[model samples]
Target: MTRKTLLILLVSMHMIFGPHSFAQQRTQKPPLHAKHWMAITGKPLAATAGAMIFQKGGNAVDAACAMIAATCTMWDTLGWGGETQALIYNPHTRKVVGINALGVAPTGATPEFFRSKGMKYPPEYGPLAAVTPGTPGGILVMLAEFGKLSLKDVLEPAIQMADGYPIEAETANLIEREKERLKQWPYSRQVMLPHLGEKREAPEPGEIFRQPDLAATLRKLVEAEQEALKQGKSRKEAIYAAYDRFYKGDIAREIVRSVQEQGGLFTLEDLARWRVYIEEPVKTDYKGIEVYKLTTWVQGPVMLQTLNILENFDLRAMGYNSARYIHTLYQAMNLAFADRDFYYGDPYFPPAEPVRGLLSKEYARERAKLINMERNDPNIKPGDPYPFQGERNPYLKLLEKWGEQQKGAAKSDSQESARSNEEFEKDFYAGTTSVIAADEEGWVVSVTPSGGWIPAVIAGRTGIGLSQRMQSFVLDEAENPFNVVAPGKRPRATLTPSLALRDGEPYLAFAVQGGDSQDQNLLQFFLNIVEFGMTVQEATEAANFNSFQMRSSFGNHESRPGRILLNEAIPSWVRAELRKMGYEMTFAARTSGPINAILFDRKHGTMWGGSSNHGEDYGIAW
Candidate 1:
């Protein structure tokens, strides 16, 4: 159908079925003949932007980049100054690529700096935790390397969206939740809150929200591209120039000035030297499907490890969301996370084992033996992931020393439950928005853009906010050598997004916005489709659970043992059985995911998409 005809048909449908009535029906039976592509995003407008890009003859990477930019605009918490990590599958090569756009700590940031201030850890909010912005670099690099569209073309939607957009109910609630923090800073208040004669208040839904300063910042990058173009640079070079402008030019200078002036750790050198690296993804095979995630720097490999361990059991036989199934899954995840706690860290650091060891089938088999279906394993410990048969391994001394250090550093068992409860109550949403796109050519991309929440102190007038990622670093330098704060080191992040391939073809692309619960949610979403035979929408809406027994990814890395939270939708009998089995149970108001997913069924030559309908998240298939 022509664009005009499609628009008319949509309008007519809305009129005939009533606004949103068609959407309800669409969820019940998602279209199987979306001719070109399908997309899901944290916001409806972002999905619309991706659809528009596809209509404009752009590819999946182009649509994904555009959707992410659009998401940053409508969801102010995740945009230019935030971090973006993506997993892209190129069908032609049948290979998946990973983007590590997560920011690194500045040279000026150190554990001693906070210690000198008489603190055990850095505050979760404000300048001390801020890292160099990574989204601009990630977006520009993706456009230059993998995309078919120019920077201007992909960024146009976000720039327009930044100028002004109607505030949705969820956005309004988010703003209200952060209003008190926003008021603490003048620039943040101006940008995020409603202005009424110099008094700031929470904005209502449907009110016009404007970010002229953010728009100007985005436009400035476009101007840099224009300048490079006029100077006879190719489109690709112009895109790089825009990146340079953000990191090495005026934008960097302003960020440095504001951050340093406000007593933060960021410097011009930090911005100038920062680079977003593209690396090989970590992969594992589960029931013939290959799952791909970004490397161990983030918590991506944990999913691979969890899947590997779960691969040993017949989850389908155990029954979906049954007590036995939940118990087995929880045990597997707990064991996997125990390894994650001790082994997962910056791969560049000392004693870092090859990522292959974490995903190895042999290692998974050994880890799977630790699970006990009848009872929860409260005293979990990391395993020897290294594959070796020698009587005495060379690294045994280091491992012993590491184990002793962790034992000394860890809090007593009696104090663990209280600390875990406090951590859960304080930090739930660790700042993220996700977007996924797929095209006719079978290219698929999943990007999780995060950070720059109101808790993150904004740089003055630059409309660029810093990331509080420094909190993810470890303060106990003696106990945690791999995750310690270091100059130019990327913190171990929780911003994991994933893509799956079936028989060497693109199958699914998905991600969620919760903090430590990301991998758990992704695993369930994957199973809900592949194991339960649910559509994308059904998979997303399926009941979800998370085991908070592992250490958090936020400040101080506090751990809680045997704490399992199940969605209210899970049967009451299952909860009762879990509690009887010694699992500390809590009924969550909702699941840990506002999961956004896209399923590409290459056999049927059809694409399916879904999003969390209860929130601002939306999806479009066409």
Candidate 2:
């Protein structure tokens, strides 16, 4: 992330509710070895390594398993033991099945759990904040059901990486940033604590660093699984034992003990009783294209809703990169995000708050009405449902002030407006990395791994910090319609992987891990391609903008003054036009998340894959 975004995040964290968030990211160029009928991810070296597993007869699923496993080693910025959400594109069925390998709130979880324990919502860094990790569980389940290779094959690269590598520019920076917090974990400091009694510097650009313990863990999984198989255990049994070793087994117990020492809440039972959530992925149709996203417990539906609102218009007619087009997108995002904040929550445990209705044509049409081709509604508020139905007036609400700001809508004065900027500046600090890939067998994968930031690394388990996802819950149980804090209820999330289909056939598998920025970029990128008919490369290269003041689930725009940030690449003329139309602007060419995408042009029978150069050069192999 650029300095501008980091500044914005500072304000958002303080004013947006919940607590401040930490970021973990890397910009290593992905290795160039996955172009030919193979699976790939964010890190070139890691993805290339996984693709090699594919060449060794591993299927696409096995390859993803390998990439994620390897990623846990080299990409320590993201937790070696965190959660993930996957979108599996199956060609034979021409249908997408969402494998929700996300972590769940503990059976003992509740909003008051933190409040009572004096543990703030964002529990700085500890087991109290950690949800059961889903990366290991999710990958294994996915591989066993869809992949043809064994666990050992999937885990090899990660094991090698953990054993050792030299520090690179990105990794070096991350370690330097977290050095203080990492001192507590022997394994963590052992790997990140620079050289022999000397400090480590940023690798010139692409350098390597190794983690022996992490390597040992990966090796343990493969070795134990291999032994289980030899012991006459069935594949399922062997896989289960492998998972146990990582979680309930020695490794997991060691982590649990360390967490307990740090006054954390992960119990032996919590680890033993933990289970992954399984739910149906959501589906929607926009611009004659069928789209699928994770269930509403995430931002994917809003992506669909935002697209639906844009579908009513021909973006090409608006002209590509025109100020008018940019303004239109901002308006659509503002409206869609309004619904997202109001209604989106864990369907399993919605807050008592009124149920927000999204994806309904009636709901979307009402949102589109707010868009004015000639004007910018900077003083934006959720408009009545577009294609307005006077009846079925569903009431959706969000916190406006500490007091009774919830009675209805409240207007902000010049003085109040000035304070909005101070409050929302915190949302800009997010940093993340993601990758997208597909193999010849008609399988596509996307992995956006983030958690365990640099500052307050986790107390134990190698200086890991739990993901800040717990922030998705509301303090007032009554405010959340479908988001009531509860045991096992997954928080509504922004990290959703997406798949786009042509004539109902899967053609695109893409994902970006930008937290709040994810929705904004996804909206612009998809609309630029679907409605405007631009290629994936063109869409990614085009300039993008986000309204920091725009109201959404993230909170009110009042937190920040009239601020809408744009990429430096956008022409001055366009910026001038937007300013004329009433948008306050900031500039940053680096804010656009590295959008990794694979476009299968069935019409041409070729795979055209490209990764953004905004922060990292993507790796493409064939």
Candidate 3:
């Protein structure tokens, strides 16, 4: 055709399709491909830290440890005092192992203590919400057991960052926004408000924010390790020495003193007694792909249960993001989460969780039958999994009361009963950052480290922000007998990292941020790849919906039954159908993730890395 004719046709096409037509043709970011290794996390610099370790000839575990340390130091939705939960695929053993570094309630943190304070649930912030720090011990243990690099080698990037680094806009602005809360803690105010009394008391974007105290703290751990090595201790022993320094030495003393001084429940013994557990992860087979998640103490197993239930449905036939697909997934997630809120808790605690039964395939089929198919079930209660295990549910009466109370609450029409959308979204998303790393040696690590986010109370001169994870515990046993507040007991947490294997080989290592939404997003991410034929990058950027039917793990532990968050791209007809089905629909421009994932192409012997475009999440491959 002539140039004039082609121009006229292109102009006509542009007018017909609009500008979005071209924009929708490609992803905002490119996918990462690597033959040897790949590193992805919530922050770019943190991912660079992992790359630094990988370039130094360290394994995936070592690189992951570095990324975790760097992210913690940078306060990328977590801090030094935050908890760490990870799933690692050990190539040698060909097994997926769990790293449970979640902190426990400190001394005097019983439900009675909280109830006596006239609080319905634990405080959402401040020292009272603090738990014993666990990330330090978690890092050391993972390094000692599986990593090849020394503690000093793994921590160098974090130490340098702790000493001084250009604070990003997100964190700097967060400090500014939370200045009032930070001001409540003397140490936090002193550190976070570098320009105190100014309009913007927090550090400016791109300012070189230094944390000498945190740098010193990291140096102390390295010093302990070096001294142990000098004393002829093995590398593992030296690492343990550093762990002891943090949990049992001067660091512990400082942490306890700071917390107690601020009216927290932490004690010297609380720090000393906290330990990280390395255990076998729970797994389920969905269409021949084995998906794994951490056990009861976290909401990880909710995804597994959801999968077990979804296994009975042909989701691919429903079409992606169809009203039918969304409703099915939402109902399945609610059923699983209902069980999670009631039954999942610290397995080491006295009242054992009915986890064996909760994970049973037959039990899942039973739960799946509860879905109404055509509409939302706002009153979905925990299933009786105990009978599946040949045991009677001891908390049957409590479960009945819980269901009644939930049903009554759901019937509320009072204006005060409805939470503001902002408040609900805040608690729903909460805070956390995920780390994903994989190497040619067969090591794959997925971590969702959280707590001690912005507005966290800094623990004295240690520069450690205390964890606010105490908010996850229920003050009333009727709410969750297995997750009641008790001294030294782990609260049911939302942090969950995931892994998948095909025919006994590593297939996917992935995790995401957002409190209760973590599993919801992750479940869809998995399905996007496994069932919808999306690439790793496509899945990470896919538009997935969320259900807020289950009780919140943060704030007042409120549940907004039938509330659904949908991506804006969902058709109006789909929204209308969901609304007719009783869903209180909400929309957002992007809804899938900030999910970071690494898909192992075993056949090609390469890794395909994906990081969502929703946030500053990034990845590097080499």
Evaluated with lDDT, which candidate comes out highest?
3
Q: What order do you get sorting by lDDT, best first?
A: 3, 1, 2
lDDT of 3 by residue, 428-463 (tens): 899899999999999999999998998898888899
RMSD of each: 7.9, 8.5, 4.0
The regions of model 1 sitting more than 4 angstroms off are: 1-33, 194-200, 348-351, 388-426, 477-479
* lDDT of candidate 1 over 216-261, digit per residue (tens): 8889899999999999999899999999998998888888888778
Per-prediction TM-score to the true structure, in the order listed: 0.90, 0.83, 0.95
Give the range where candidate 3 is weakest over 10 consecutive residues by summed lDDT: 12-21
Candidate 2: TM-score? 0.83
Write down the TM-score for model 3: 0.95
Give the higher-lDDT candidate: 1 or 3: 3
Worst 10 residues of 2 by lDDT: 16-25
Q: How accurate is candidate 3 locally (lDDT)?
A: 0.90
Output the better candidate (1/2) by lDDT. 1
Q: Candidate 2 local accuracy as lDDT? A: 0.62
Local distance difference test values of all predictions, in order: 0.77, 0.62, 0.90
Candidate 2 lDDT over 438-523, as tens digits, reads 77777877666555444333435433334545555555533434655566666666677788887876667677766677878777
Clashing pairs in 3: none
